[model samples]
Target chain A: MKLHEYQSKNIFSKYGIPIPKGRVATTAQEAKQIAEELGGRVVVKSQVLVGGRGKAGGVKLAKDAAEAEQLATQILSMEIKGLPVRKVLVDEASAIDQEIYFAITDDRASKKPVLIASAAGGVDIEEVAAKTPEKIIKAYIDPLLGLREYQARDVAVAIDLPRDYWKDFTKIAMGLWEVYKNTDASLAEINPLVITKDKKLIALDGKMMIDDNALFRQPDLAEMRDTDEDAPAEIEARKYGLSFIKLDGDIGCMVNGAGLAMTSMDVIKLFGGEPANFLDVGGGADSKKVAAAMRIILTDQNVKAVLFNIFGGITRCDEVARGILVAMDEVKPSVPMVVRLVGTNAEEGRKLLENANMITAETLADAAKKSVEAAKKGK
Target chain B: MSILVDKNTRLIVQGITGNEGLFHTTQMAAYGTNVVGGVTPGKGGEWVLDGKIPVFDSVKSAKDATDANATIIFVPARFAPDAMFEAADAGIPLIICITEGVVIHDMMRVRNYLDQKKVRLIGPNCPGLLTPGEAKVGIIPGDIAIPGNVGVVSRSGTLTYEVLYAMKNLGMGASTCVGIGGDPVNGTNFIDVLEMFEHDPKTEKVNMIGEIGGNEEEKAADFIAAKMTKPVASFIAGQTAPPGKRMGHAGAIIEGGAGTAADKIKALEAAGVKVAKHPEEIPTLL
Candidate 1:
């Protein structure tokens, strides 16, 4: 889940990371109050998950409280990247001598947590990677050993920090890693870890992505989830314990496994069809789960046909057939359905499905063809 | 042969006392998997599935009794990492974590621990894997998979089944199929499974289904370009999803031009992997 910049900075400050004092405001009056409390120049930023907020005019600099309120009013009323600004973060602006980037995130290939730092900051990291990859230095941390003094120093030196600031930089890097690990964040980034004109280092901007799975362990962080920014269908799917991804195709796919769901979509495309969504009911889903999945898929007006492909191993084919029947009963789908059942009790499951008016395929290819045809006919 | 599990592979189900664990374990046992035991903390010393498998207090004891080489987890996301670490430390070579919602940080720690111990972990939020007619270890529907020559690997579980259904309709059967999971910090990746598929002689063609997330697809494309000898047909989902929205998979978000489906498709196509524009086109491409 994504946290707003102000929320992330709040957590960062709690962890001893130096951040300009900021307040989150939902109204212009609140923003003005925050700007007045800061007593100087403030930066008004929109709270959205998407990037390029500055380019979208979601961010503005204010000389004082009144301008800050005006800017907040403007930003809060505007939409950036299709997401409306629900809140504005009013923060004290910093004077920077140099800007640097630092982040800690998981590196899947190395199966380790990696810390990334760059001397060049305040710009898109992808641009740096594309234009000058060497400027970015990465350090893979040992989980058991944690981020050591030497590892943090290596990154500090790689970013060309002055010798006097190396120790401070190391402390900051280690602290950032600690915050990342403690918060269960998938990503914790500090962009423009600026060297103030006064020569003190501080994090100008903070961003964090908390791991959804780990939310159970961190109730404090879990509350930061912004359901307002999430897709409605996804929010509903979560309630039903279904893993649903809404796609743009016309054929709706319902499968029991993630791998199977992707391949089903691939095969649909192979047969000149497009999948409207990726819905996995998970292993041993009962009729209730199936009904919930159906409801979620039917919400998508783009779905012209539905495909049910079941390979009953740990999941019984008969149970799946029953689930489909229950879902069909509850949803009363106008679209056609093509089902392919195999594995243990598959024959029995197929027998149950055969009683329904829906088309049944002996193989996935036949099922795809039928579903695609059904979808095209609807189109 | 299968890439992960077979009839000979002894299995242990973590969180076996849960509703989901009990349901799938019974199905797995009925499918002829050597489901030797289960782990559920204090619920140990009980029988979960008709007294066929013994339930133990922990993975260590389960391993001691069953000599289980592989584990399939059905625990909640909160306990998933600890379950994975427990199994890994117990020397379980293959750990298929079916639990979802494991915080990425916990997964990172679990993955790091697994790596240090040289353990192979499949997913923390993924549908487990199936070897097709051998031993099905994941939540994937079994009936769609017909043991054949095509190897299927995907980030999306339901999409994998759709691919299998298409392949089967086209008279193409699967040798082994794996869902590497859709979380951003999953244990196994597309490239890791692709490397395994590359060496498996039973796999005639590979169907790789990817979604928007990370640069894993691009990395897989790089591996396929350099070493893969088999024909690879791939499809990337979420092309229609608006830019910057978190589509479906937690990891499938398009962020900062890094994990866009279009970017992945482009990379896969450039790397000589046959790219499918839609889900229905995979069979013909194969």
Candidate 2:
């Protein structure tokens, strides 16, 4: 659940955070029109959901409307980090006196939302934290108390900001926190919170990633998801209540739990086979969901072999076997298949699949080794 | 001698009238857990599962009736946090939440309340722990566990089962196995379980299963080096996981170079723990 920069800025504006006026443009003419209205000088940014767009040449500064249109034309037709530039933000460029980095993310160790701010801005903050270390300051906001005035001041002072801008910095920080809390955002960041020549602060770039588990209450935020930003198989997998991530290799992994699915992938690699994709049917997955999962995995042409490694606790092996039987009839996949069934009703499930032309393994290690050999043979 | 639940763990199932609640409750009782009763709000005064278990309206009433010291949740996400808070208030010392998708914000509040009350919460998204042949709680299969001295702690559901199966394959049975859940924030962590295993008399060796996400594994490595005297073997998943893309679990992601499997492996190995390159290597390493 990642939001594009323009989308993030839209949410930021609602919280009273200052942002440069910008409009999303699908075509170069729209970008030029927005640039002309903003007095010609503007930054054309690709609205992809990945970082390093500037390094990938998806971000460009134009001196005037003519250059804005040319840059937009170049950016709109290009791809950055495998994401196409379907839309670009034409934003008014401002003169910056200084830049600062600011963000709010969940700290797993503390189990609280932490505010990370630094005086050094407009670059990779992780790099800064790794290199300088002391320049970056993190403040954990108490959930009940929230970002207190003193806590906000700690970040500002730690960044070595002038006393005159402390109050304004606190206001922006609070606003950012509001956006994060209200949107159910896992992460909310504003890189290069710039100080203009006149001493007014504005967020030059914005990013927000909403927690998927909290989407039930945040319907409005959920609607902002761009399916175009996701792979088609991934989108299809979600509809069936299955979690899927496409990978490069020959073996397709289908497991029940998230941890098991990752282990299935890792074991494949360890056994000298690369995983084509990661798929978790999730607990309580029924026959229909299992069929849907197989259908989605079969659509991956890179997958030459399919492995079913299930530890059926909440997810019964019998139900999974039934689903595979149903899928085998529908998909009729030509690739080799290997399965290792264990736990509840595994004997019945294995009985159901015994007639199918699939190799069965006694252990996960055997399953991985067999799947690798079968996949390589198929290749 | 188990780390958490054992032969004495009397259990209450929250949302007991629901489908998952009834299923696992029946299984837990069959596995010899003293599943006393259950709570399903309006379904009080009724009997479920062929009238073998009593049903109460709230955790307090259930506790009063069953003398239940522990409770496991099977409620939906919307009511999970409230069920947890109610169980804590009802004086249940051990709370095992099997309900996945509990809101992160709700967890924060529940965690704070649990800290004040000195309660042990495990897995809002986890498979509850098992103490081999003695007691079973949550959803881990009872048949695979064999009574032995190995202690296992994991952040994953299926991977824990895989590791336990591996140990069982090599004639190494477990004392107890705990899945702390795969969410970014959980009720318990690796260090907590490791510390418990360090002191447990029945446990001889320890197995840790970690994946991508926060630096918890790295921190746990430091804890093992500083406090733990028992031999520890570890395995980390998601070495091929792409950076910035979450691999299924909310917490399993390679972000900011902190949660990479390589970094965690390097840290854990530096702490004198035998790090398994694969699951099959774990039993040998230990």
Top candidate, metric lDDT: 2
Candidate 2 lDDT over residue span A71-107, tens digit each:
9999999988777889999999999999999999877
Give the alpha carbon lDDT tens digit for every residue of B74-119 in model 1. 9877778788889988889999988766766666677767887999
Compute DockQ for each candidate against the true complex. 0.39, 0.71
Alpha-carbon error at B220 in model 1, in Å?
Answer: 4.1
- Candidate 2: deviation at residue A66, Å? 2.3
Measured with C-alpha atoms, the lDDT of residue B100 in candidate 2 is 86
Q: Please list all clashing residue pairs in model 2, or write none if there are none.
A: none
True contacts kept of 1: 0.50
